[model samples]
Target: MVKQIRAFNQLKELALSQEILEDSRTKGVVTALYEALKSRDAEAIQKILAPDLEWWFHGPPSHQFLMRLLTGEQESDFRFVPHSISAFGPTVLAEGFDQSRSIAWVHAWTVTDGIITQVREYFNTSSP
Candidate 1:
């Protein structure tokens, strides 16, 4: 029916709009997180993360597993450049490297429920 067609079109438009908004939000979160790394500020990182969260690096970290990756000797070297981002349900995947001049994998994040519930970092003698 014509009414059904109109409703379908409206729904499609709304879904597209939501996708755009979500993409923008994802970009914002990525930028904010990177800034936190550069600053090495724990408080700033906590601002965007939920209180109950955990990190799981693909490989083991050179150092011990930690809660917030702020305040350290080589903290300045912590950086990541995400290659691609995808969202599935409540999860967001950001696969990149904590790289600078080198392409070694530093850290990665898999955020969920609008907060970073899990972190997959591999900061060591490993390749991304």
Candidate 2:
């Protein structure tokens, strides 16, 4: 019985280690995307994002800053600096507040095989 318990504990630790590795990979992909954005490298952003990327937004039309930024329609003065980032499986969550615009934003990004496939954007709102 002691041997069995030890084996179970070992398996649990392995599972947790795998989860941490996955989380790190997911976060790495999202962080790279943000780096690409910060550099305004459209080609790099395109490489990170899937060609058929899916996007959903909840906020005023004017607040669709990410999309505009991606499309080169956003004003140069605005910036999105995520204060918190967390990952669960294939989904990554990033939250930030922009004092200049008084906008609080959250982004739920789904990454697959190191490519960003989907994004749900919320601006000026609280996320549960």
Candidate 3:
């Protein structure tokens, strides 16, 4: 969690230092997270997620792990939705919708000498 906060702070500093530009589609992704969460739709989450994804929430990893590992619902009552978004470097912090609300997440973009090699997700636990 500290690492995530540090990364977010770094992003803020960088944004303050430069004229930041972002894609509208990325905003759509943020909205999509929200829509998905409101509906508790994993399919929606999958749609926004990159093919090679790695997600981590601030709380339990089970729901996400179950989605990836079991390929379906293990039990109901667990769900997440996305909220606002912020970009720092190659990282993205998307707030989640639901109960646990441990502050949603998604980290991506591997840089090599200043180019993105890969982008993926770091899913967060859902909350009410």
Q: Which candidate number has the best lDDT?
A: 2
Candidate 3 deviant stretches above 4 angstroms: 1-20, 40-43, 61-70, 81-83, 96-128
Ranking by lDDT: 2, 1, 3
lDDT of 3 by residue, 1-128 (tens): 99999999999988766635443334445555556655768677566555554433334555363244325545555444445566554444555444454545553433322322344545554543
**Root-mean-square deviation of each candidate, in angstroms?**
4.0, 2.9, 11.3
**Highest TM-score scorer:** 2
lDDT value, candidate 1, whole model: 0.58
Model 1 spans with C-alpha error above 4 angstroms:
63-68, 71-76, 81-89, 95-101, 106-108, 122-128
Report every candidate's CA lDDT: 0.58, 0.89, 0.50
lDDT of 2 at 13: 100
lDDT score for candidate 2 against the true structure: 0.89
Q: What is candidate 1's lDDT per residue for 2-120, written digit by digit as tens?
A: 99999999999999889877766755665577677656667878876767667565554444323324524443344555666565434555556433444444444555545666656
Query: How well does candidate 2 match the true structure, expressed as C-alpha RMSD?
Result: 2.9
lDDT over C-alpha atoms for residue 48 of model 3: 57
Candidate 1 TM-score versus the reference: 0.65
Whose TM-score is higher: candidate 2's or candidate 3's? 2
